[model samples]
Target: MGYVVPVRANISSINFHWQSLVRRPMPYEISFRWNDPEAMDEPRANVSYVGYVPRVESVFSVLFPCTGRVSAVVSVDIMLNITTYQPKQAIIFLKLKRSKTCLQGQPTPLNEAANDTVRLVLGGAEQDLSLVLGVTGAIGVTFVTLGGVMMFYVRQRKAALRYTALLSCWSLEPEQRPQPCDLLGWMQDLSASFDRLI
Candidate 1:
């Protein structure tokens, strides 16, 4: 049998988020997570209490078998004395299950938003908000450009018809037809005339 990693009272977990858009430091939430509810209800491990074996490293782990479930439980140990701030901690028990067939013992699902999972939205403070917003805006622009390119490619098969129609109009000389499309306008000043059809 494997041994449980120890947790102590003074010891705590820390998560920090910095948002550059609003130039602010988001809230820092500290907490705990473990494989077994029984094991986590009362933290058995902390800074002072080493487990069955003394580990010189700053980090330790405890693994839990999930039976036939898709996700595995995990516990990571860290020293509590290194941080300046601490907060109230709470544990959430998740009993919700998957509707589709799930593989046994897969890694935990950690998307940006997942129910019954540990998620903290954090970022920089007001001073850094501009930076964050800059990055976000850049990303938004890139996505728009990509979407436009995709739309163009998807419509490429039909674009030939539109191009052919325009060519037919421009091919006639101004003198040969009634109100011919001003070819000189296209050859000399395309930008001014192109706006009509665009």
Candidate 2:
């Protein structure tokens, strides 16, 4: 049978075998993993690498599918901050995991899907970095400055103290916390936390 995919789908419902039909996405890194009950906090794909986009050509890739009941599409969508300079690589990868047991498993994509899915898409998009930055960045800057002023009025907000509280509850041995974080980028104040951690 043939799988008809939309131009863009939610990053949560991706499958590995659909690589061929996938539209070339943002030039982002990709990795895949099987579900794992033991290490819910760590990435099970055990694969990590950077992606480079010479020309954002049409994208296609075929891999195994998810074995477990729930499906997830792990992706990174970055709109570049610089004009004229494109990202190195941008694509999404499907990682498989079991929802109930949280165990990791891998299923292969069908042959036809595999054959049709892996090409990169390239060309200039009608994106206005200036507008995005001007609007979103302006809002962020306003809130941050306002927040700083508010912080002055309120009690001290100690990030170190709060993060310590989180680490204190996390088990060294794996157990599924209702919301486990496999993606470090998805963690709470991860960027700032990293600054504190190191």
In terms of TM-score, which candidate is strongest?
Answer: 2
The regions of model 2 sitting more than 4 angstroms off are: 1-27, 33-48, 65-124, 128-198
Deviation (Å) of 75 in candidate 1:
32
TM-score of each: 0.20, 0.23
- Candidate 2 TM-score to native: 0.23
**What is candidate 2's lDDT per residue for 1-198, written digit by digit as tens?**
123243122111222221122234334455433344232222222122444334423333423333443434422221211112333343334322222222245333234242323333333343445556679999999999999987764433455554564575474445643255553533546546554644
Off by over 4 Å in 1: 1-166, 170-182, 186-191
- Candidate 2, run of 10 with poorest lDDT: 75-84
